[model samples]
Target: MSILFTRLRHTLLPRRNTVARPSDRIQVALLLLLLLLSLAAAAGAILLGAGIHVVESARSVEQTASRYATTAVLLADGPSPGTVGRSGTAGEPGPARATWVTRNGRRHTGDVDAPAGTVAGNEVPVWLDATGAPAERPLTPLAAAVDATAIAAGGWAAVGFLLWLAYRCAVFVLDRFRLARWK
Candidate 1:
């Protein structure tokens, strides 16, 4: 058992002649720098990816809201009321309120009220739920533009980070090769 342990120790220990060469110092420095650069770039890329994900999620929500929205014309010229009413029974008539016009021009009358933004004679977009009820509010063009800009920025940032990482890796490899040749 002692002999076996001695053999294992001898195998694990490094030989004196295997010590790093003079040129290896520069190689080590370059490798350290490369590792740092890689870490920094990875962090930047992760941040960019997260930003992109947020933008995409916003976009998806907007798209889904738009899909669920119904097209309606204002019955009277005024802002929509904040409260909306549901369909009444056969004997009970629905509340007196504005009606929504679908894409097919089908008039659906209901007491469901929307926020005051639409005016009579003005065609506005409105979202409706599965129960044929209004759902989402209006979206401004500025909001959409901001979302697009965020997505673009995130994509560009990710690309820039990857390019920087590539550059650092190339420089590290070239430096290591030069040092090896010098020895």
Candidate 2:
């Protein structure tokens, strides 16, 4: 065992007069910088994605508010007969429009398209907002999970970069020390 240990140490240990090369330090530095930049890029991408999600959610909320104010109703009834040939056009009301029965028994026509497979008398939520928009909802769990993955990847990259930097620095310092001792 002692002989094996001695042989292993001898083969692994550095010899005298071996100096730390400038190229080696440069390589380490470059690797560290690359890792750090990659981490930063990942973090930035996550932030950008989150920002876009927030904007979309806000737009949905605004639409929902508009729908609520406009007293819109989901056409519980199937599409009207005349709506068969109707093409959905912007600002053009279709014949298949659902009527919103207000509390006063007054009915108002809404511009929302009926859901697919909806039969006559299927109750759907009515939006009363003026803009006919739906409210924004929070990000889905899947989206949040993706963001979390990005964050974790960035963290791992940062840790790896730091460890690499420490290792390279230690190697350089030890080499210098050994060179000095030999002198």
Top candidate on lDDT is: 1
Candidate 2 C-alpha error for residue 10, in Å: 18
How does candidate 2 score on lDDT? 0.54
Tens digit per residue, CA lDDT, model 2, 68-167: 4233445455454444435553333233356666544566664555544455555555444343333233345455556656655666566566766776
* TM-score (C-alpha) between model 1 and the true structure: 0.34
Candidate 1 per-residue C-alpha lDDT over 100-179 given as tens digits, one digit per residue, 9 for 90 to 100? 86555567865544335445554555677545667655444455556656665665566667756765776677778877
Estimate the TM-score for candidate 2. 0.38
**Which portions of model 2 miss their true places by more than 4 Å?**
1-26, 42-95, 102-106, 131-183
Q: Count the backbone clashes (under 3 Å) in each candidate.
A: 6, 23
In candidate 1, residue 38 scores what lDDT? Answer: 63
Lowest summed lDDT across 10 adjacent residues in model 1 is found at 87-96
For model 1, the stretches where C-alpha displacement exceeds 4 angstroms are 1-18, 69-183
lDDT of each: 0.57, 0.54
